[model samples]
Target: MSDRFDPILLSELIASHKQKIADLGVVIRYNESFEELEDKLPIDSKAALTPHFATALNTYTSANAFWLGGFDEDDQLVALSAARLDDLGGQAMSEYLKRYWRRCYPAEDGDLAEASETQPRFWNEVRGRVAYYGDFHLKREGYQGRGLPKVFGPLAMLVGAQKWDADWYYTWVRERDWSMRYPLAYGFSRTYFPGLRWVKPPSSIEPDLAAGVNSRSDVLDWMETLSRPGEQALNK
Candidate 1:
Protein backbone atom coordinates (compact mmCIF):
# COMPACT_ATOMS: atom_id res chain seq x y z
CA MET A 1 0.00 0.00 0.00
CA SER A 2 1.19 3.51 -0.76
CA ASP A 3 1.49 6.14 1.98
CA ARG A 4 -1.95 7.03 3.33
CA PHE A 5 -0.99 8.81 6.55
CA ASP A 6 0.20 12.33 6.82
CA PRO A 7 1.80 12.96 10.23
CA ILE A 8 -0.29 16.04 10.78
CA LEU A 9 -3.45 14.27 9.67
CA LEU A 10 -2.74 11.27 11.90
CA SER A 11 -2.12 13.55 14.82
CA GLU A 12 -5.51 15.09 14.23
CA LEU A 13 -7.18 11.70 13.99
CA ILE A 14 -5.69 10.59 17.29
CA ALA A 15 -6.61 13.88 18.93
CA SER A 16 -10.21 13.58 17.83
CA HIS A 17 -10.41 10.07 19.24
CA LYS A 18 -8.96 11.21 22.53
CA GLN A 19 -11.39 14.12 22.79
CA LYS A 20 -14.28 11.72 22.35
CA ILE A 21 -12.85 9.54 25.12
CA ALA A 22 -12.40 12.45 27.54
CA ASP A 23 -15.93 13.66 26.93
CA LEU A 24 -17.26 10.25 27.95
CA GLY A 25 -15.28 10.09 31.23
CA VAL A 26 -13.66 6.84 30.16
CA VAL A 27 -10.63 5.58 32.09
CA ILE A 28 -7.83 3.21 31.10
CA ARG A 29 -5.82 1.31 33.71
CA TYR A 30 -3.35 -1.54 33.70
CA ASN A 31 -3.95 -4.79 35.61
CA GLU A 32 -0.85 -6.50 36.96
CA SER A 33 -2.61 -9.75 37.76
CA PHE A 34 -4.94 -11.88 35.66
CA GLU A 35 -7.40 -12.54 38.51
CA GLU A 36 -8.24 -8.85 38.80
CA LEU A 37 -8.91 -8.36 35.09
CA GLU A 38 -10.64 -11.70 34.48
CA ASP A 39 -13.39 -10.94 36.97
CA LYS A 40 -14.53 -8.12 34.72
CA LEU A 41 -14.14 -8.95 30.99
CA PRO A 42 -16.37 -11.43 29.20
CA ILE A 43 -14.78 -14.62 27.93
CA ASP A 44 -14.76 -14.99 24.17
CA SER A 45 -15.53 -18.63 23.33
CA LYS A 46 -15.24 -18.10 19.62
CA ALA A 47 -11.64 -16.96 19.92
CA ALA A 48 -9.20 -19.06 17.94
CA LEU A 49 -7.39 -20.01 21.14
CA THR A 50 -10.46 -20.35 23.35
CA PRO A 51 -9.50 -23.68 24.83
CA HIS A 52 -6.06 -22.45 25.81
CA PHE A 53 -7.01 -18.93 26.90
CA ALA A 54 -6.54 -19.32 30.61
CA THR A 55 -3.55 -21.58 30.19
CA ALA A 56 -1.93 -19.05 27.92
CA LEU A 57 -2.59 -16.16 30.29
CA ASN A 58 -1.48 -18.03 33.39
CA THR A 59 1.57 -19.47 31.72
CA TYR A 60 2.81 -16.25 30.17
CA THR A 61 6.20 -15.37 31.59
CA SER A 62 6.14 -11.79 30.38
CA ALA A 63 2.56 -10.55 30.21
CA ASN A 64 0.69 -7.43 31.19
CA ALA A 65 -3.03 -6.73 31.46
CA PHE A 66 -5.01 -3.56 30.97
CA TRP A 67 -8.68 -2.82 31.46
CA LEU A 68 -10.62 0.05 29.87
CA GLY A 69 -13.79 0.74 31.80
CA GLY A 70 -16.32 3.35 32.81
CA PHE A 71 -17.55 3.99 36.34
CA ASP A 72 -20.14 6.24 37.91
CA GLU A 73 -19.23 8.41 40.91
CA ASP A 74 -18.12 5.09 42.39
CA ASP A 75 -15.89 2.45 40.75
CA GLN A 76 -16.93 -0.84 39.14
CA LEU A 77 -16.20 -2.93 36.05
CA VAL A 78 -18.45 -1.41 33.41
CA ALA A 79 -16.12 -2.23 30.51
CA LEU A 80 -12.83 -4.12 30.16
CA SER A 81 -9.64 -4.89 28.22
CA ALA A 82 -7.72 -8.20 28.00
CA ALA A 83 -4.57 -9.25 26.10
CA ARG A 84 -1.89 -11.95 26.36
CA LEU A 85 1.71 -12.55 25.30
CA ASP A 86 3.80 -15.20 23.57
CA ASP A 87 7.41 -15.61 22.39
CA LEU A 88 7.44 -17.06 18.89
CA GLY A 89 9.88 -19.87 19.64
CA GLY A 90 11.83 -20.79 16.53
CA GLN A 91 11.08 -24.34 15.38
CA ALA A 92 9.76 -25.57 18.70
CA MET A 93 7.33 -22.69 18.87
CA SER A 94 6.28 -23.34 15.32
CA GLU A 95 5.41 -26.94 16.22
CA TYR A 96 3.43 -25.76 19.22
CA LEU A 97 1.58 -23.18 17.16
CA LYS A 98 0.85 -25.56 14.29
CA ARG A 99 -1.49 -27.58 16.48
CA TYR A 100 -3.52 -24.49 17.33
CA TRP A 101 -3.46 -23.22 13.73
CA ARG A 102 -4.65 -26.62 12.52
CA ARG A 103 -7.61 -26.44 14.85
CA CYS A 104 -8.51 -22.79 14.18
CA TYR A 105 -7.63 -22.85 10.50
CA PRO A 106 -8.10 -26.48 9.49
CA ALA A 107 -8.50 -25.73 5.81
CA GLU A 108 -5.32 -23.66 5.66
CA ASP A 109 -2.90 -26.60 5.57
CA GLY A 110 -1.07 -25.51 2.43
CA ASP A 111 -0.43 -22.03 3.82
CA LEU A 112 0.64 -23.47 7.14
CA ALA A 113 3.14 -25.73 5.37
CA GLU A 114 4.71 -22.78 3.61
CA ALA A 115 4.88 -20.84 6.86
CA SER A 116 6.53 -23.83 8.46
CA GLU A 117 9.12 -23.95 5.73
CA THR A 118 9.84 -20.29 6.26
CA GLN A 119 9.76 -20.60 10.06
CA PRO A 120 13.49 -20.36 10.55
CA ARG A 121 13.71 -17.33 8.31
CA PHE A 122 10.81 -15.54 9.95
CA TRP A 123 11.90 -16.37 13.49
CA ASN A 124 15.38 -15.20 12.65
CA GLU A 125 13.75 -11.95 11.56
CA VAL A 126 11.66 -11.82 14.73
CA ARG A 127 12.70 -14.10 17.63
CA GLY A 128 13.85 -12.14 20.68
CA ARG A 129 13.73 -9.02 18.53
CA VAL A 130 9.96 -8.75 18.45
CA ALA A 131 6.98 -9.21 20.77
CA TYR A 132 3.61 -10.37 19.56
CA TYR A 133 0.53 -8.59 21.00
CA GLY A 134 -1.45 -11.83 21.02
CA ASP A 135 -5.06 -10.68 21.24
CA PHE A 136 -7.08 -7.79 22.59
CA HIS A 137 -10.83 -7.65 23.33
CA LEU A 138 -13.11 -4.86 24.42
CA LYS A 139 -16.65 -5.02 25.72
CA ARG A 140 -19.40 -4.43 23.12
CA GLU A 141 -21.31 -1.89 25.23
CA GLY A 142 -18.39 0.12 26.58
CA TYR A 143 -18.53 3.86 26.19
CA GLN A 144 -17.43 4.20 22.63
CA GLY A 145 -16.34 6.32 19.76
CA ARG A 146 -14.51 3.59 17.88
CA GLY A 147 -14.06 1.33 20.96
CA LEU A 148 -10.96 0.40 23.01
CA PRO A 149 -8.73 -0.97 20.28
CA LYS A 150 -8.69 2.41 18.60
CA VAL A 151 -7.56 3.87 21.93
CA PHE A 152 -5.19 1.01 22.62
CA GLY A 153 -2.22 2.81 20.99
CA PRO A 154 -0.65 4.05 24.21
CA LEU A 155 -1.40 0.86 26.09
CA ALA A 156 0.42 -1.30 23.55
CA MET A 157 3.47 0.97 23.63
CA LEU A 158 3.48 0.88 27.42
CA VAL A 159 3.37 -2.90 27.41
CA GLY A 160 6.18 -3.12 24.93
CA ALA A 161 8.36 -0.66 26.80
CA GLN A 162 7.89 -2.30 30.19
CA LYS A 163 7.87 -5.96 29.19
CA TRP A 164 10.09 -6.50 26.18
CA ASP A 165 11.83 -3.17 25.58
CA ALA A 166 11.25 -4.40 22.08
CA ASP A 167 12.46 -2.78 18.87
CA TRP A 168 9.30 -3.87 17.02
CA TYR A 169 5.91 -5.46 17.66
CA TYR A 170 3.50 -7.49 15.52
CA THR A 171 -0.02 -8.87 15.66
CA TRP A 172 -2.18 -10.79 13.18
CA VAL A 173 -5.61 -9.48 12.30
CA ARG A 174 -8.36 -10.99 10.15
CA GLU A 175 -8.01 -9.79 6.57
CA ARG A 176 -11.12 -7.64 6.53
CA ASP A 177 -10.94 -5.93 9.92
CA TRP A 178 -11.38 -2.16 10.07
CA SER A 179 -9.12 -2.17 13.13
CA MET A 180 -6.20 -3.04 10.85
CA ARG A 181 -5.82 0.69 10.43
CA TYR A 182 -5.39 1.11 14.18
CA PRO A 183 -2.08 -0.79 14.31
CA LEU A 184 -0.68 1.34 11.55
CA ALA A 185 -1.44 4.36 13.68
CA TYR A 186 0.74 2.75 16.31
CA GLY A 187 3.57 1.94 13.86
CA PHE A 188 3.00 -1.78 13.15
CA SER A 189 3.58 -2.65 9.49
CA ARG A 190 1.83 -5.68 8.05
CA THR A 191 3.70 -8.47 6.29
CA TYR A 192 2.49 -9.49 2.85
CA PHE A 193 2.69 -13.22 2.42
CA PRO A 194 1.39 -14.82 -0.76
CA GLY A 195 -0.85 -17.10 1.30
CA LEU A 196 -1.53 -17.56 4.96
CA ARG A 197 2.00 -18.06 6.24
CA TRP A 198 2.90 -20.45 9.04
CA VAL A 199 6.13 -20.29 11.08
CA LYS A 200 8.57 -22.95 9.93
CA PRO A 201 12.24 -23.64 10.73
CA PRO A 202 15.26 -24.07 8.50
CA SER A 203 16.96 -27.43 8.02
CA SER A 204 19.97 -25.65 9.52
CA ILE A 205 20.30 -22.49 11.54
CA GLU A 206 21.99 -19.52 9.88
CA PRO A 207 22.85 -15.93 10.78
CA ASP A 208 19.93 -13.66 11.49
CA LEU A 209 18.71 -11.29 8.82
CA ALA A 210 18.02 -7.59 9.36
CA ALA A 211 14.45 -6.46 9.93
CA GLY A 212 12.76 -5.56 6.66
CA VAL A 213 9.00 -4.76 6.83
CA ASN A 214 7.51 -2.30 9.28
CA SER A 215 4.34 -0.35 9.98
CA ARG A 216 3.62 2.33 7.44
CA SER A 217 4.89 5.88 8.06
CA ASP A 218 1.48 7.30 8.94
CA VAL A 219 1.17 4.71 11.67
CA LEU A 220 4.61 5.54 13.00
CA ASP A 221 3.73 9.21 13.01
CA TRP A 222 0.78 8.62 15.30
CA MET A 223 2.91 6.45 17.56
CA GLU A 224 5.43 9.24 17.95
CA THR A 225 2.77 11.67 19.17
CA LEU A 226 1.29 9.30 21.77
CA SER A 227 3.47 10.27 24.75
CA ARG A 228 3.22 13.99 24.22
CA PRO A 229 -0.31 15.23 24.93
CA GLY A 230 0.26 18.78 23.70
CA GLU A 231 2.01 17.48 20.59
CA GLN A 232 -0.93 15.15 19.90
CA ALA A 233 -3.23 16.65 17.31
CA LEU A 234 -5.83 13.94 17.98
CA ASN A 235 -8.65 14.44 20.44
CA LYS A 236 -8.12 12.98 23.90
Candidate 2:
Protein backbone atom coordinates (compact mmCIF):
# COMPACT_ATOMS: atom_id res chain seq x y z
CA MET A 1 0.00 0.00 0.00
CA SER A 2 1.18 3.53 -0.70
CA ASP A 3 2.03 5.15 2.63
CA ARG A 4 1.84 8.87 1.79
CA PHE A 5 -1.86 9.59 2.15
CA ASP A 6 -2.96 12.69 4.07
CA PRO A 7 -6.29 14.40 4.67
CA ILE A 8 -6.14 16.70 1.67
CA LEU A 9 -5.14 13.94 -0.70
CA LEU A 10 -7.98 11.80 0.57
CA SER A 11 -10.45 14.62 0.03
CA GLU A 12 -9.37 14.85 -3.59
CA LEU A 13 -10.32 11.20 -4.07
CA ILE A 14 -13.82 11.86 -2.80
CA ALA A 15 -14.11 14.82 -5.15
CA SER A 16 -13.15 12.69 -8.12
CA HIS A 17 -15.74 10.06 -7.23
CA LYS A 18 -18.35 12.77 -6.93
CA GLN A 19 -17.48 13.90 -10.44
CA LYS A 20 -17.87 10.38 -11.76
CA ILE A 21 -21.30 10.12 -10.19
CA ALA A 22 -22.29 13.39 -11.77
CA ASP A 23 -21.13 12.11 -15.13
CA LEU A 24 -23.52 9.18 -14.66
CA GLY A 25 -26.44 11.59 -14.22
CA VAL A 26 -26.26 11.71 -10.46
CA VAL A 27 -25.84 14.78 -8.27
CA ILE A 28 -23.34 14.64 -5.41
CA ARG A 29 -23.16 17.96 -3.56
CA TYR A 30 -21.15 18.78 -0.49
CA ASN A 31 -22.60 20.83 2.28
CA GLU A 32 -20.25 23.82 2.18
CA SER A 33 -22.32 25.75 4.67
CA PHE A 34 -23.59 23.30 7.26
CA GLU A 35 -26.61 25.51 7.69
CA GLU A 36 -27.23 25.69 3.96
CA LEU A 37 -26.44 22.02 3.76
CA GLU A 38 -28.98 21.29 6.43
CA ASP A 39 -31.53 23.31 4.54
CA LYS A 40 -30.88 21.58 1.27
CA LEU A 41 -30.62 18.14 2.82
CA PRO A 42 -32.99 18.11 5.74
CA ILE A 43 -32.67 15.55 8.51
CA ASP A 44 -35.43 16.33 11.00
CA SER A 45 -37.96 14.02 9.39
CA LYS A 46 -37.75 10.23 9.32
CA ALA A 47 -36.49 9.53 5.83
CA ALA A 48 -33.59 7.95 3.99
CA LEU A 49 -31.97 11.32 3.36
CA THR A 50 -31.47 12.01 7.05
CA PRO A 51 -29.20 9.05 7.63
CA HIS A 52 -27.51 9.65 4.30
CA PHE A 53 -26.59 13.21 5.25
CA ALA A 54 -25.50 12.28 8.72
CA THR A 55 -23.32 9.43 7.48
CA ALA A 56 -21.78 11.56 4.70
CA LEU A 57 -20.92 14.50 6.98
CA ASN A 58 -19.57 12.19 9.64
CA THR A 59 -17.32 10.46 7.11
CA TYR A 60 -16.09 13.74 5.64
CA THR A 61 -15.24 15.15 9.03
CA SER A 62 -13.44 11.98 10.03
CA ALA A 63 -12.09 10.40 6.81
CA ASN A 64 -11.82 13.32 4.32
CA ALA A 65 -14.58 12.28 1.88
CA PHE A 66 -17.87 10.49 1.48
CA TRP A 67 -19.71 9.48 -1.72
CA LEU A 68 -23.45 9.86 -1.16
CA GLY A 69 -25.60 8.36 -3.97
CA GLY A 70 -28.59 10.15 -5.41
CA PHE A 71 -30.44 10.58 -8.68
CA ASP A 72 -29.83 13.83 -10.55
CA GLU A 73 -33.09 14.38 -12.36
CA ASP A 74 -35.39 13.56 -9.46
CA ASP A 75 -32.93 14.51 -6.69
CA GLN A 76 -33.60 11.25 -4.89
CA LEU A 77 -30.94 9.52 -2.85
CA VAL A 78 -30.13 5.92 -3.78
CA ALA A 79 -27.06 4.84 -1.84
CA LEU A 80 -24.17 6.07 0.29
CA SER A 81 -20.47 5.07 0.16
CA ALA A 82 -17.48 6.64 1.89
CA ALA A 83 -13.84 6.22 2.93
CA ARG A 84 -11.73 7.83 5.65
CA LEU A 85 -8.03 7.86 6.39
CA ASP A 86 -7.19 5.50 9.26
CA ASP A 87 -6.62 8.46 11.55
CA LEU A 88 -8.95 11.24 12.72
CA GLY A 89 -10.93 11.40 15.96
CA GLY A 90 -14.08 12.71 17.54
CA GLN A 91 -16.65 11.32 19.97
CA ALA A 92 -19.49 11.61 17.49
CA MET A 93 -17.41 9.97 14.81
CA SER A 94 -16.32 7.20 17.14
CA GLU A 95 -19.85 6.66 18.30
CA TYR A 96 -21.09 6.59 14.73
CA LEU A 97 -18.56 3.93 13.80
CA LYS A 98 -19.22 1.99 16.96
CA ARG A 99 -22.87 1.76 16.05
CA TYR A 100 -22.07 0.44 12.59
CA TRP A 101 -19.56 -2.04 13.94
CA ARG A 102 -22.03 -3.30 16.46
CA ARG A 103 -24.67 -3.64 13.79
CA CYS A 104 -22.35 -5.37 11.37
CA TYR A 105 -20.49 -7.56 13.89
CA PRO A 106 -21.48 -9.73 16.76
CA ALA A 107 -21.44 -8.40 20.33
CA GLU A 108 -20.21 -11.68 21.82
CA ASP A 109 -16.98 -11.71 19.80
CA GLY A 110 -15.19 -8.94 21.69
CA ASP A 111 -15.02 -5.17 22.04
CA LEU A 112 -13.63 -2.71 19.49
CA ALA A 113 -10.19 -2.58 21.07
CA GLU A 114 -9.54 -6.27 20.56
CA ALA A 115 -11.06 -6.27 17.09
CA SER A 116 -9.03 -3.29 15.88
CA GLU A 117 -5.73 -5.08 16.56
CA THR A 118 -6.27 -7.38 13.59
CA GLN A 119 -6.09 -4.48 11.13
CA PRO A 120 -2.32 -4.28 10.75
CA ARG A 121 -1.87 -8.01 10.27
CA PHE A 122 -4.75 -8.13 7.83
CA TRP A 123 -3.16 -5.29 5.87
CA ASN A 124 0.25 -6.92 5.81
CA GLU A 125 -0.97 -10.36 4.79
CA VAL A 126 -3.46 -9.02 2.27
CA ARG A 127 -1.01 -6.42 0.92
CA GLY A 128 -3.64 -3.74 1.23
CA ARG A 129 -4.30 -0.77 3.43
CA VAL A 130 -7.56 -0.55 5.38
CA ALA A 131 -10.13 1.98 4.23
CA TYR A 132 -13.69 2.00 5.56
CA TYR A 133 -16.06 1.50 2.53
CA GLY A 134 -19.64 0.95 3.65
CA ASP A 135 -22.80 2.86 4.39
CA PHE A 136 -23.80 1.67 0.93
CA HIS A 137 -27.47 2.12 0.09
CA LEU A 138 -29.62 1.69 -2.97
CA LYS A 139 -33.24 2.64 -3.17
CA ARG A 140 -35.25 -0.43 -4.08
CA GLU A 141 -36.57 1.24 -7.21
CA GLY A 142 -33.26 2.45 -8.63
CA TYR A 143 -31.21 -0.67 -7.92
CA GLN A 144 -29.56 -2.17 -10.99
CA GLY A 145 -26.41 -4.23 -11.52
CA ARG A 146 -25.01 -2.75 -14.73
CA GLY A 147 -23.28 0.43 -13.56
CA LEU A 148 -23.25 0.64 -9.78
CA PRO A 149 -19.89 -0.95 -9.00
CA LYS A 150 -18.24 0.71 -11.97
CA VAL A 151 -19.56 4.00 -10.70
CA PHE A 152 -18.38 3.61 -7.11
CA GLY A 153 -15.93 0.77 -6.39
CA PRO A 154 -13.22 1.46 -8.99
CA LEU A 155 -13.51 5.17 -8.37
CA ALA A 156 -12.92 4.53 -4.68
CA MET A 157 -9.98 2.26 -5.48
CA LEU A 158 -8.41 4.78 -7.85
CA VAL A 159 -8.86 7.46 -5.24
CA GLY A 160 -7.41 5.24 -2.54
CA ALA A 161 -4.50 4.16 -4.72
CA GLN A 162 -3.62 7.72 -5.74
CA LYS A 163 -4.24 9.67 -2.55
CA TRP A 164 -3.49 7.12 0.13
CA ASP A 165 -0.61 5.44 -1.71
CA ALA A 166 -2.47 2.22 -1.06
CA ASP A 167 -1.21 -0.84 -2.94
CA TRP A 168 -4.42 -2.71 -2.07
CA TYR A 169 -7.77 -1.91 -0.44
CA TYR A 170 -9.91 -3.83 2.07
CA THR A 171 -13.43 -3.67 3.52
CA TRP A 172 -15.51 -5.90 5.87
CA VAL A 173 -18.46 -7.75 4.38
CA ARG A 174 -20.88 -10.25 5.85
CA GLU A 175 -20.28 -13.73 4.45
CA ARG A 176 -23.77 -14.37 3.16
CA ASP A 177 -24.59 -10.90 1.96
CA TRP A 178 -24.59 -10.69 -1.81
CA SER A 179 -22.72 -7.39 -1.80
CA MET A 180 -19.71 -9.37 -0.64
CA ARG A 181 -19.65 -10.83 -4.14
CA TYR A 182 -18.76 -7.44 -5.63
CA PRO A 183 -15.46 -7.20 -3.76
CA LEU A 184 -14.49 -10.75 -4.65
CA ALA A 185 -15.20 -9.94 -8.28
CA TYR A 186 -12.94 -6.91 -7.91
CA GLY A 187 -10.10 -9.15 -6.63
CA PHE A 188 -10.62 -8.85 -2.86
CA SER A 189 -10.40 -12.10 -0.95
CA ARG A 190 -11.86 -13.24 2.32
CA THR A 191 -9.34 -13.36 5.14
CA TYR A 192 -10.29 -14.03 8.72
CA PHE A 193 -10.57 -11.07 11.06
CA PRO A 194 -11.91 -12.06 14.46
CA GLY A 195 -14.91 -10.41 16.13
CA LEU A 196 -16.48 -9.34 12.82
CA ARG A 197 -20.04 -10.63 12.40
CA TRP A 198 -21.84 -11.15 9.13
CA VAL A 199 -25.22 -9.44 9.03
CA LYS A 200 -27.77 -9.94 6.31
CA PRO A 201 -29.28 -6.98 4.56
CA PRO A 202 -33.08 -6.94 4.40
CA SER A 203 -32.92 -7.89 0.74
CA SER A 204 -29.94 -8.37 -1.55
CA ILE A 205 -29.43 -9.59 -5.08
CA GLU A 206 -26.97 -12.32 -6.02
CA PRO A 207 -23.80 -10.72 -7.41
CA ASP A 208 -23.02 -11.21 -11.09
CA LEU A 209 -19.30 -10.82 -11.86
CA ALA A 210 -16.68 -12.82 -13.70
CA ALA A 211 -14.91 -15.51 -11.73
CA GLY A 212 -11.90 -17.59 -12.62
CA VAL A 213 -9.17 -18.87 -10.33
CA ASN A 214 -8.82 -17.30 -6.90
CA SER A 215 -6.81 -14.14 -7.63
CA ARG A 216 -5.88 -13.32 -4.06
CA SER A 217 -4.71 -16.87 -3.40
CA ASP A 218 -2.55 -16.70 -6.52
CA VAL A 219 -0.89 -13.53 -5.19
CA LEU A 220 0.02 -15.27 -1.96
CA ASP A 221 1.33 -18.33 -3.78
CA TRP A 222 3.59 -16.26 -6.04
CA MET A 223 5.13 -14.53 -3.03
CA GLU A 224 5.75 -17.79 -1.21
CA THR A 225 7.13 -19.57 -4.26
CA LEU A 226 9.46 -16.76 -5.36
CA SER A 227 10.73 -15.43 -2.04
CA ARG A 228 14.24 -16.66 -2.80
CA PRO A 229 14.64 -19.23 -5.52
CA GLY A 230 17.18 -21.02 -7.74
CA GLU A 231 20.15 -18.70 -8.54
CA GLN A 232 19.06 -16.27 -5.85
CA ALA A 233 19.06 -19.03 -3.23
CA LEU A 234 22.47 -20.22 -4.41
CA ASN A 235 23.93 -16.68 -4.16
CA LYS A 236 22.52 -16.19 -0.68
TM-score leader = 1
- Show the colliding residue pairs in model 2: 1-167, 2-165, 2-166, 63-84, 79-137
| Model 2: per-residue Cα lDDT over 46-142, one tens digit each | 2433232354434345244444445558765454444444432222222233344444333333432112322223323322333445444544445
Reference-based TM-score, model 1? 0.53
lDDT of 1 by residue, 1-236 (tens): 33443446445554565555455565545554554555544433322233223544344433433333433234554443334444444534334445544443323233322234444344344443444454354434444455545555545444444444444455544444423355444445454332134453222211121221242342355455655678755533
Candidate 2: stretches off by over 4 Å: 1-24, 28-63, 87-129, 178-180, 185-236
| Residue 61 lDDT, candidate 1, scale 0-100 | 35
Worst 10 residues of 1 by lDDT: 203-212
TM-scores, each model vs. reference: 0.53, 0.46
**Global lDDT of model 1:** 0.43
Off by over 4 Å in 1: 1-23, 43-53, 56-58, 61-116, 119-124, 146-148, 178-180, 191-195, 198-222, 225-236
